[model samples]
Each structure stands twice: as structure tokens, then as C-alpha cells.
Target: MTLGSRLTALPAVMMTPVAALMLATLVVLAPGLALACEDLTNRTQTAYKAGDLATLKDTFAAAEANADCSAETLQWMGKAIVSTVLRSVHEDVSQGGSLQAHETALREARPYGQDWRLEAWLGDIAFERGDFTEAATAFQDALNTLNDEELTPTAPDTAVIEEVYNKAEMARLAAADYVSAPTTRSGEPGGLAAPSYRGFQPAARLVPVEFQFGSTLVTPKGLRALRDLRDALRASGTQSITLVGHTDPVGGMAANDRLSLARAESVAASLRNEGYTGQIYVVGRGERDPLQWVAPLTQHQYHQALRRVEVRQ
Candidate 1:
């Protein structure tokens, strides 16, 4: 029988909307398992970005419940996880968390296949992490995958081909033979790499935290932000934090310096209480390095911006 004949012979009960599109070439048509898996591809990326592990767990279960552990699901699942991990690594490096976050993602998704976008990201991650050879190889693999008619559903456009070629050539400049890099520590448990660092612009304020004026107290809102920052830093294997405090040009300039140091110490104490054993370095730049240079029209705006400790991981 011809390809059309086989599709036509499929029972009505087994027909999905996807299966009906005979002329289309997407390999996403099947029963309950395949459908859930299809939905999972996007949902997993969303949940990872939101820092909602609970939601990720739910999505994983929904996709797996009806899944037959097929090759397609495995490939897409690996792709989703790779995306999550790449986001984490970049976010870490950008946020001063740690650049090492890319290792497990690279090791985990490599077995899936020569997925173009995934390999492209893998190349960038390796390049940024100083693994030039892997970067070259992965980018080359991406270019090859994009060129392969059998592997890709459609040939990549000229623009895409040019972009991939540019990235690959850049990698080749620094490329050389090197040993395969190790994955994350063998004893470390595998879990979602976090904070969905895609389009992640760290808040303009100091570590997205705020402090009460004159007192060493952190506001409730500040506490929540600090906890999130602390967790991500620790999870990234960061071993130390530096807290730099600043104060508005209020009261005696000298006195403000003392107060600022006190505030930094207060925040440091809170992190210690939370079981962060790493060294906490505190510095006070009272009215010295004002974030708001122009005298604010109002006192509230001036003090609010200055009265905080910035976190450096």
C-alpha cells in the first residue's frame, strides 16, 4: 500500500487532527500519549521560566501518563530540558551565580540527537563557558543538521544558514582537540535547572531587594526577593556573597556610612540564618556611590533608591 493508503486505513477511532493532515510532514500524530507529549513541549518551557517546579512536575506527569515512552517524546523532552538548563547557565553567568550550570544540560541532551536549535544553544553555552572545541563541534553539528534533508523536515532558509555558519566559523577560530568535558557531579541529583533565565533582566534595583530606612530591618517584600536570590545563588554552587550598602545623603555623611554597614551586616545575618555558610563580605558606601545622581524632586524617591544593599554572588 502507498503512504496515503496506510493513513486512510487507520481507524476513525485512532484518527487525531494531526493524523488527518496527510500532506503535512510533522511527526506529531498519534494517540493520547503523543498528544500530551506535544502539549508538553511548550508547557515545560513556560513552567521552567516561571520558576514553578510544581508546575513543571505537573506537566511532566501529564505528558508521561499517556505516553508510551516513544522516541519522539524522548527527543522533545530532552529538548525542553536542554532549553531550561541553557537558560539557567546563562542566567547564572549573567547574574554572577556561576557559569558551570551548563555542564549537566550539555551532557543530558547530547544523547537525544543532532537537534539544530538545541545544538546551537549547546555551542553558545560551551563557547561562553570557555570550552572552545565543544563549541566548534556543536556548531558544526548544528550546521550539518540544518543541511541534512533526511533529518530536517524543511531546509533552513538562507538567513538561518548564514547565521549558523557565522557562529560555527567563530568557534573554529578558537577550536582544538580536547577531551570530552565531565557532567555535573556524579552524586548531585538531577532536577530542573532554574529561574527560567530567558530574557532574564536582573531587576535594576540592588538584587531586587529593599530595606527599611534607618533600621537594619528588611521589609517583607525584600525578604521574599532575598530568599529567591539566595536559593539560586546557592544552587548554582556559589560559595560567597558580597553585600555592598549605600545610603542617601541624609544626616551626617559619616554617620550614614556606619548605618549602611549595619544594614549590610543585617542582611548578611539573615542569609546566615537561612543556612548559607559561605563568606559574606560587607562594604559601606554611604552617600558615596548614589544610584540616583540628580537630586530627586522628592525625599521619598531619593532615599528609596539608596537605602539598600546590593547582592554580589
Candidate 2:
């Protein structure tokens, strides 16, 4: 089944609304690391594809132990474990999976030096959970990690190197936009700035649709939110729509800036798929603006509040 179909098919006990959607967006957080270690990678991929968390946990533990054969192998294994566990805990019976496992693997990988992948995944988690502040923070940390020349270099393949650069750029752009979400301030009505950057009321208050990490694909809740938005728009005499996409501060800012635009494009694609023909316009804001301002609060609340796309009439 497709990612969306799989998510919808899962029982609530297997996956909560937030975790299900959040994980779905980050299916490729590790990118091509799997290609480097096909044998170990296959076991993990098979378990995930089958939705067998039991097999997944054991397989990961085995891979974690056996895969320390090389520098890249060790780093990739830890990265994949943390990346997958963040999703698996919200899936079918953990059997043996837990966040503790992720930490354990990370502690083991400390000998390999920090990598951008770990920070990137954490940012993605925060972003998916609706926490923009943390997402931005993590993304920034990932970028800083990338600055270290000592990190194991990619293999001699030019294509892989280019892909790495692109992903990094994407993360940077994404982080740039994500940071804005926390710092943005609105201009008061009857003053110099626009009345409200938050967009039209009622619609703004209810954003039912939540996207998957690094993707514009909406979750089941996001779909329902869109349905409600469609009806609301029709009623409001909205001649056309402007989809503004935002990114949690993760990955490369350039990439995520495009990601913000991609989100708008993705929504527009969904509209088209649904046969929406009105003047559907998309604006990729690239995380330059945020609907909510950052303040001292729980990380979860910060995550849930940022990492969203807003609709304008």
C-alpha cells in the first residue's frame, strides 16, 4: 500500500494520529545510507514494510551490534535505528522498541563523532509533532554538525556526494524558515504592518490537516481539514485560494525553502486531484514566516504549533 493508504489502514492502537502522520513524512530521513549496507539494511526495511515491530526491534539490535564493522556503517546504523525507532514506538506492538533503544544506539555511536543525520532526524520529529522551535533548533545544530570536516566522507561516487550537498542545502533552507516561525511578530491592525499574519479567522483557528515531515503530503487529519477548508472557502466566496507552505527548521535551509514551496505545490496537487479548478495559487513561503510566535513552553507544544501551512482567502 502507498504511505497514505498504509497510514489510514493502521489501527489507532498501532499508531496515534500525531505519530502516524509525523513518521510517514520522514520515511527517507537517512536517504541512501541503506544502499551502502544492503544486507543489514534489508532486514530493517523488511521489518518496517511488514509492520512487524517485533522483528524490527530485534533486527535493529542485531544490526546495531554486527554493523559496527566500519566507520560509515556504525554511523549509519545508529542513524537508522534512531530514525526508525522514533516512528516504531508509535506503530504496532513495540515488542522491544523504545526511545531508550535510540539513546543506547546513540551513546554507542559517540565514538564515531556526531553526524548531521541524528540532529536532522530529531528536527524532523519535532517538526512532524508540530514543534517548530525545536525543529529549527535541531536543524541549526545539524548544519553545524555538517561544518565539521572530520565526519566520514561519502564514498567516491559523484552522484552520492551531490545528493548529500542537495539534502544539506534543503536542510539549511528549511532551518531558515523554521527559525522565522519563532521570531515573527505581527503588525497591529490600523498600524504599519498587515492586520494579522495569521490569516483569515475561523479557518486559521482550525488547521485540521497536518503534513508528514519533509513532504507536502497531508495526513488523514489533514485531508479532513482540507475538506472543511474547501467548504469554508466556498461559503466565504473565496474566488481563489493561496496555499502558503512552511517547514520546520530541519535539513538544509535552501532545500526546506523549496520544501515550503513544495508543500504549497503539494496542496495544490491535491486540489487538482480532487478536481479543484478555481484559481488555486500556491506560495512557498519557505519558513520565512510563522503563524505562531515562539516563547518558553513545552517542546511538544512548540513542535505542534509550528511546521504547518496556512490558507489565505
Candidate 3:
């Protein structure tokens, strides 16, 4: 037999037990490796869904290091990283921090390569951070990338993809809002408060608010407190009130800034509707102001307490 033929036939002459052992090893280790990869994927998904950017980041880093990850898994990991970054941007804007931070996070996630959803998310973050110029640029980039070829119908077909696209559009609109809305001073104390209230003792009022993941709406409990506060302030003859919003250091500063503003605005709107005629000043402190000074608390707990609107009468 030729040398190549002999080499090919060598496998046929191998003992059945040896062949079986090789197959067994593959069968044993393959599934184990797959399961480990699956577990990591699930962890990343959970963190992304929960808007837990920090956890998502850690999991993505671990997944990147895993040799067993398939191409599809790696792609998913990349998407997760980008999504986490967008979520971080949203948190930063909601909390009223530097838009530069959001930009930095987006750049870090850019390696996932020309993701329209991610670009849209960046635009939205910029818009919320009051950087209309950046927001417009991001929105344009997202729209440029999106085409009918990428569109999919139905939840089973490409739900995640569609959802990401929707988020991009939302970001675009948010940026537009930044452009059209009345210019408000970012949490920075604008020009010294008129001297009228200089000597006024800052009356403090505790306001409770709740936030579900990915939502800024106030709960019934929050609305009730705001209504009561409105009535009390009207009767108390206070000249003005400071509406301060705070959040936990779970997401990026931009996202936290936006969330804080939303909370404060919700409360302020309720107060205005309830006939509060006094001056209302809104401030978003982001994660900078924590009710508790302790470190190492879970993001969930810290968020629960941090996502609050306090009224200083």
C-alpha cells in the first residue's frame, strides 16, 4: 500500500476499545464545555436584562477568555457588551453626569462593529446628557446602518434584534427632545439663587419613589407622597422647594442623571398639577449622594434607596 493509504487504514486497525475511549472523552468533555459556556451566556443575558452593566461587563470579559465559545457565542458576547454599554449610558444621562463618560463607554463597546442599535443607544445617551450635536451624529449613524435586509417580523424571528433597533430609535427621539426642550441647567447651581431666600431655613421633606428596571415612572406610593407634599407646601407658605434626585452607582453617570431627572420631573409635575405655585428647582445628583455611607452593598438595594426624589422646602 502507498504511504498515504497505510496512514488512512491505520484508524481501521485501531482497537474498538481505544476508539470508544476517544469518543467517550469527546462526549464527556464536549457537553461539559457547552454547559459551562451556556451558563456564562445565561449570566450575561440576565445581567443585560436587569440593566446590571457592571455584572454584564464582568461576564463578557470571562466569556471572551473561554476557549470553548463558538463563533455565535462570541457574537452574542459582543452584543451583550454593547448593550451593557448603552444601558450604562442611559443610566449616566438619567443621573445627570458628564456626557463624555457615556461617549467613552460607547467607544469601548465599539469593537462589536457597526451595530446600529448601539449607535442609536449612544445617540440617546448624548441627547439625554444634553449633547444634541453628538446625539444627532449617533442617530444618523444608526439610521445609515439600518436597512430592510436587517428587519425581521415576529417575536420568534428576531425579537432581540428588533428590540435593539427600537431602543436606537428611542435614543434618537431622546436626542431630539434635548434639542427642542427648554434649556435647563444641568444639576449645577445656576447663578446664585436670588437673595430673597438667602436667609430662609431650608425645610426638608422626604419623598419616596420606586423604579423598576428600565423604567422611570413613579409608583402609586410615590405619587401619593408627591400629592401630599404639594398640599403641604401650598398651605405652609414656603417660597420655593428643591427637588433633588439620586441613584445608586449601578449604571453609567449619564443614565443615572437621566433617571434622576425623570424622577424629579415626575414629582415636580405632580406638584404643579396639585397647585404648587412656589418656585421649583430640580437637581440630579446621580450616584454621588447615597443615603447610606456603607460600601459593598448590592446594586439592587442601593438602587432601591437611591432612586428617590427629595423635596427641600
Candidate 4:
């Protein structure tokens, strides 16, 4: 069955409202390295054509373990593995195939190749299991990949793309709301924060803070999302919070640096308004730091993920 068909076919209990539509829009949407892996090409190609998900999974895992597979070969195997997963998402997740297991498989396959389709599936499964934070990130990852292609004049599925974008954005907001949900209500601290610049010291964490495009104005919705972060500070007795600003590689370096810093300042201001009395530290990395960097910058979605303020807590 197609991805959309598979989604709709899922039991009501397993599918989210956004899950159905989010995957439906993806209807229109690899090689490896190894010499001892000479047989790798034939085996992966055969499994892909035959829709053998089990074999694809085994082959990918083995290939990865062998340490001899070329990037091209592993990437091909990764695509095949993803295809099998999509073809069998429902069965895999419903029949003793835990969401975590499938998610783990996809995560392993991701470095081999990253694309809109894989990320969309990742988002779909995450949403299925109520991991909205992960769902939001995966969906945004897919949207950014899609948007990167949209920069081309001949981009197809423009309408379908927008539908997907709306749903993805909605998922993200839902995630933010979940994060903002009181600890008393959520029964836990916020889900793992959005990814931050890797090279940042003391590790990078993010609040659900968002800013308007090309402007430092924090959205009203974004302002509301800071409650969880504020509460976390209170709970931890953390005396200070650090805010690091980052931007997508859309504009000049100097301009992005300034914009990123400005964006962080905006969030800092919002935090104070939200009753965060701690010493707030702010700095901007500009385009120097991105959560995920895709080339050509035409891929606005990837850039979108990069453009944000992160909290070092």
C-alpha cells in the first residue's frame, strides 16, 4: 500500500488526526560503500524490488556493522530500508513491533541518507506513539527538505506541500503546548528540548521560543510556550539561564549574527515578562551554528530549524 493508504488503514487508536493528513501529502515523494560488500548491491536491490522489509532491515544493520560499506552503498540500503518501513508501518508498529524499535531502525538509517520522505515517516511514527516533540522535529525536518526543493521553479506538489506544512506547523505548536503544559498536568518535565548547536559549551538545550521571520518579535504563541522553561528554572533552583541565538544560512553572515542575537534578546525579554527572575545570559551565533545545515540555503525548511534561540540550562 502507498504511504497515505497505509496511514488511513491504521486503527483509529494508532493514528493521530494530523498523522493521516501529514503522510497523505507525502504521496508524491541511495548507494553504499564496501568491497567485501560487493554482494551488497545485488542483495539490497533485490530486497527493495521485492518489498522485503525484513531483509532490508537485516541487510542495513549488517552493512553498518561491517564497517566496509561505502557511503553510497549504505545510503542505498538506507533508502530500501525506509521504503520497507513505510510499506509496513502499520504492521510493524502494531504487531509486537514497538514504536521505539522502528524509530531506532530509522535513526540508524538516517545518517546514510536524509531526505523528506524518511523524515516524514519518522514524524508519522513519532506522532503515532504520542511523542509529539520528536514528531514535531521530524516533520519540520521533512518540511525543510521539501521547502529546499520548492525554491526551484519547477517544484511540483506545491499545494500538497502547503497542506503538509500546515499540519507540520500545527504539530510543532501542539508540541510547544505540551511543553508549556504544567508539570502538575504533564506529570514530567518538558520532553527533551529541541536540538541546539553541538559545539556550544555546557551542552545546548532549547526552549520552545520562536520569532517572526526576519524580525525579532516573539510570536504570541511562542511567548506562551516559555512557561514550562520558567517553571523548570523554579524547580531546579537554577540561578541563571543562558540564551544562544542562531539563524539559518539565508542571509549574510554578519546580518544573521545580528539577527540571531536580536532574536535571543527578544526571548530574554519575554522570559522576564513571564516572571523569570534569574540572571539571563544572551549571545548570538548567527549562521555560524545551525541545528541542521542543508546546502544552497534555498531549502528554507532546514534553515527554519536552524533559526531559533536555545537555552543552556
Candidate 5:
């Protein structure tokens, strides 16, 4: 059916007064412009159905430039554009594309008014980049919005809300730790890696060092604690220290393994910079050894506790 006939066939409830006013304005502007808008909208619908992101992007932009398009038509085009961009971002992440590379695309979709989804994507980008403070703020903004279903229609509403909430809480904890306390030294059960060594104790004592999620750098407070350890080891004449790195079970096993080991290496480097001459052994167990293992639903709550480097002397 032609676009005009389809419009006329739509139920009255489907046509808002704003949409009707837009149609009247389109008619007054120029019949040819209205026809052009209809043609562009048709092309957009076809591209969206075919999952032709390139064509959908082109047609959406064309429609946006033409005021002859009805409000309803533009709204549909906006949804299509945002959906296409979101799918592309997911694809990029699956293929190991840098998160920063697709951040601009998500930001560009902001004009489409899917604030919840756009903010959620921005939060993910910040989280992956190790900017926990920004991530927490973005996730909080997403939580304040009420239309996550508009973006992730396939996922269960409760699951989506829970996931976003967990991420936000995790980010908030990491951000808070970064600002106030960088070193966590306690006999906390979930904090220990429980290395294989049997009762291996040295004269010097070292504790597990907490790290920000997806990060490998030693924090300033952690550096200070390591300096103290270095001085104690020197006094005790300790010959070697074991550093075991760990992460929460959030990402793929292989990636988590690499990240865990990277965290240990970062600590070792910091110790070396502090002039600790003792031998250093580093191990990356990844998520294989969690001080406390919880279900995926509650994993984020323990993420900060899990992402740590154990210093055994």
C-alpha cells in the first residue's frame, strides 16, 4: 500500500494530535516534499527490516533534514537508527573492538532521545576504560530513567534492571575506594588467594592489595603500603615474595586470566621501584580462585573484594 493509504488506514488512537498537525504542516509545506519524505521513510523501513545499518543511517539522516516528515514517521526512524547503532556496538564488543571506538556512535544517538540506553552504553564504556567515577554517574542516570524496555526489548525487564543496578553499585564502590581508601589490609576471608604454599611464613608480613575493576595499576595508597613492606622485608632479610593476582568472574576466562596476571605484574613493578631487592614470583589465577564465590546475580557486590593482588612473603 502507498504511504498515504497506510496512514489513513492506521487506527485513530495510533494518530496523535501532534502527528496529525505534523501531517498537515507537511502538506502545506509542499506536496513534493511530503512525497520525498514518504519515499525516505519507506526506504528507512526496508533498510531497518533488512538490517542494513548503512542504508538505515543514510535514510534516517535524510528524513531528519526534511521537515515534511510526520512526527510519527520521524519517531519510528529515530528508533531504527538507535537500534541499529546499539546492535553495531554490541557486535564491536563481541569482536574485541576497543570500547572507545564505538563511544562516539553511542553519543551521536543521544539526539534520538533513548537516554536510558545511551547512558547505559556510556556507562559501559567508562567502566571498561577504568573510569569508575564517570561510570557510576552514567549508570545512575540510566537507573533514573524508566524505559529500558524501549532499548532492550528481548531481555527480561527484571534482569536488565538488576544488571544495570549491580554495575552501578560496583562502580560506586570502586570510585569510593579510589577516593578514600586505596589499601585494604585485613584478615578478610574473601581477600585471601590461599596460595599453595603450606604455612610459608616469613619475618615480614604483606597483605592483599585491592585494585579497581579492569585495572592493573597500583594505587598511591597501595604504593605506600608496599614501601612499608619493602622496608620490613629489608630489615627481616627476606629473600623472596609471592604475588598472586585475581579478578571477579565477570569476563571470559582467558581475558580474566590475563588481567589477573597483569595486576600482579603491576604490583611487582611498583615494588621494584621501591627498591625491594627480594625475588618476586607472580601468578595469575584469574577467576579460578575467588576468596568467595557467589552466583552471577550477586557477583558485582563482591567484585571489589575479588579483584585484588595477594602479597605473600
Candidate 6:
């Protein structure tokens, strides 16, 4: 049976008055299932605040299927679900699966009240249908109709909100970067390859130097690779080198940034100590320019890989 139907089939029976009392006591003591609905509500609000439609949709789906939900709760739950689906439609119009899923949710939630959420969903649908003006109008109307007074005032932990906000900002910036400087044939941003300077030519490049986890100390292999790079740069008559450090997403942004910077500095120091007199430009991009999105690496592996430095002439 389908998950929803199976959930609905669960017996609410009490064998006896005493048993019913015990069940009631259990419900009072452990209201996790009931509280899940509330959690969904909170998560939906968070998703909206962060402009994260994916999380919003997942939370809304959970809330809709909640067996403990009452008609009153369903009203908010329905609205939240619809809002999320609409956002998804706004993002990717060709996602027919998402569209159908939202349609199903809307059907389920419609009885609750077609409030601002419904309007927002309609706007999203219109946008997906390539009616941008209608979508904008709908979003504006939905925003205007939001019952700020009715919304629960309990705020999430400050740190979490800040983190989410920062990530959203980062994603927005990344999108802007991709649009402004499209990836070139060589996989670097903009259609230009790294300029050949000094003795170093693009064609003679070896495997890009990588780092150990969360450390600035270069591996013997990494050092050897740098030696080769130094020789090439010297031969090519390059006057300067740029050392860039990158990290995978594993920790807080500030911490990652610091770590990446430190890694770059460590590499630069090593190069300087080796009597390579060329000017060095050190930069760190912590977990921002990942080689892999949704890394298969364990947290330990990810952190290790992030602790790496690269050299460019």
C-alpha cells in the first residue's frame, strides 16, 4: 500500500478504558509525532526565510501526511506545501514530476483554505507556464496577504538562521558568477585558459597539487609537485606565482575561510623558503569552489582534501 494509505490505516483503537487512559498518558508524555507537525511548520518558515524551496517541499510533505494533524493544523500545513511546490515550479519549469507532486498536494490542501499560499502557488504555476508578469503579481499578492500577526513568534536558534542565510547568499553569488563568467572550454570560468608564462606552458602540466585534510603541511608528493612547478615557472621566465587554497564544505564558513587562507600561506612560506624569489599572490577559497558537488568523500576525507594549495604562474 502507498505510504499515505498505510499511515491512515493505523488503528486508533483502545482495548479498554484503562488502556485508553494509558494511550492518552503516552501521547502526553511523548508527543513527538504531534510535535513533528509543529517542527514541519517551523522548518517551512525557515525554508521560506532562506528561499530554499527543496527543504520547504520535504517539510510540507511530512506535515501533510501527519496522522496526528487536525483540521486547524492542516490549514497551515496545506498552505506551506502549496507555497513550496510553487517555488519549485518557479525554479524549474520542465520538472513535470515536481509539478504533478505539487498538484497532488494542492488537491489535498485545498479544503483547508486557499489563502495567500494558494495565490503564491498560482503565481508560481503561472511563472512556470512562462507568464512572468502574472507570477510577479501573484507573489506580490501572496506577500501582501501574509498574516504576520498570526505567525508563531518562536524563533529558531540564531546560529542556524545565520548559517542558512550565509549559504543562501553564497549560492546567490555563485549563480551570479556562473551567469557573468560562463565556464570556458578548459573548465575555468571564462573561455580563457591559464596564461602560459615563463618556462611553464599549459601543455606540460601535471596533476594539480592537492593537500592533506585540514592541515597546511604539504605532503612529500605535494612538495615534489611544487618543485617541478617551480622549475617550469623559472624556465618560462615567470616573475610571479599565485598560490590558491580550496576547501570542501565541512565546517562553518568563517572557519573554512581561515583554514583555506592558512593553507595558502603555508604553501607560500614553503616556496619562499625554497629560494624561489618570484612574487607570490596567496588566496583561499574555502569550500566555495568544490571539485565535486555532493562529495562522496567522508567528512574526514573532505576536510583533508580541502587543506590543499595550488600554484599558478
Comparing 5 with 6 on lDDT, the higher-scoring candidate is 5
Q: Count backbone overlaps in model 5.
A: 0
lDDT of 5 by residue, 1-313 (tens): 2223322322222212222322232222223336758788678767755667778778877777888777767766777766666656555554555546878888887776554556766876777656776776677566544223343333324445455555664565455343211211232111111121122222322243667678886555455445655655565576888888888888899999999999989888877887888899999999997552212224464676677776666
Off by over 4 Å in 5: 1-36, 50-54, 96-98, 115-117, 146-157, 173-313
On TM-score, who's better, 2 or 6? 2
Rank candidates by lDDT, best first. Answer: 5, 4, 1, 3, 2, 6
Q: Pick the candidate with the highest TM-score.
A: 4
Candidate 1: regions farther than 4 A off: 1-205, 292-299
Candidate 5 lDDT for residue 60: 72
What would the TM-scores of all predictions be? 0.37, 0.34, 0.33, 0.42, 0.41, 0.32
Per-residue CA lDDT of model 6 for 156-228, tens digit only, reads 2333222222222122112211111123233432101123212223321212345665666666546654665
TM-score of 3: 0.33
* Model 1: lDDT of residue 207: 47
Query: Which candidate comes out best when scored by lDDT?
Result: 5
Candidate number that wins on TM-score, 4 or 5: 4
Scored against the true structure, residue 206 in model 5 reaches a CA lDDT of 27
Candidate 1 TM-score, C-alpha based: 0.37
Q: List, residue by residue over 1-313, the lDDT tens digit for candidate 2.
A: 2223323422332233334433443355354554545666676566555555566556556655664335555454444444354444433223433333354444343343354455544544454444554555555444444433344232212332232233332232233232311111221111001112112122222233457777777766466656655555543455777787777666787997888888778777876676566788777766567543322345543444455667766
Give residue 78's error in model 6 in angstroms: 72
The residue-by-residue lDDT of candidate 3 on 1-313, one tens digit each, is 2223322322233111222322232222223336659888777667656767677677767877888777667666666566556545444544554445556677777875445545655654564545544654565455344322232111112333333333332332222222111111232111111111122222443345555554567655455545555645654577788998877677899998888887787677777887778888998877777663222234554466466777775
User: Per-residue alpha-carbon lDDT of model 4 for 215-268, expressed as tens digits?
Assistant: 887656566656656766666667787899887677788998899889888878
Off by over 4 Å in 2: 1-208, 294-297
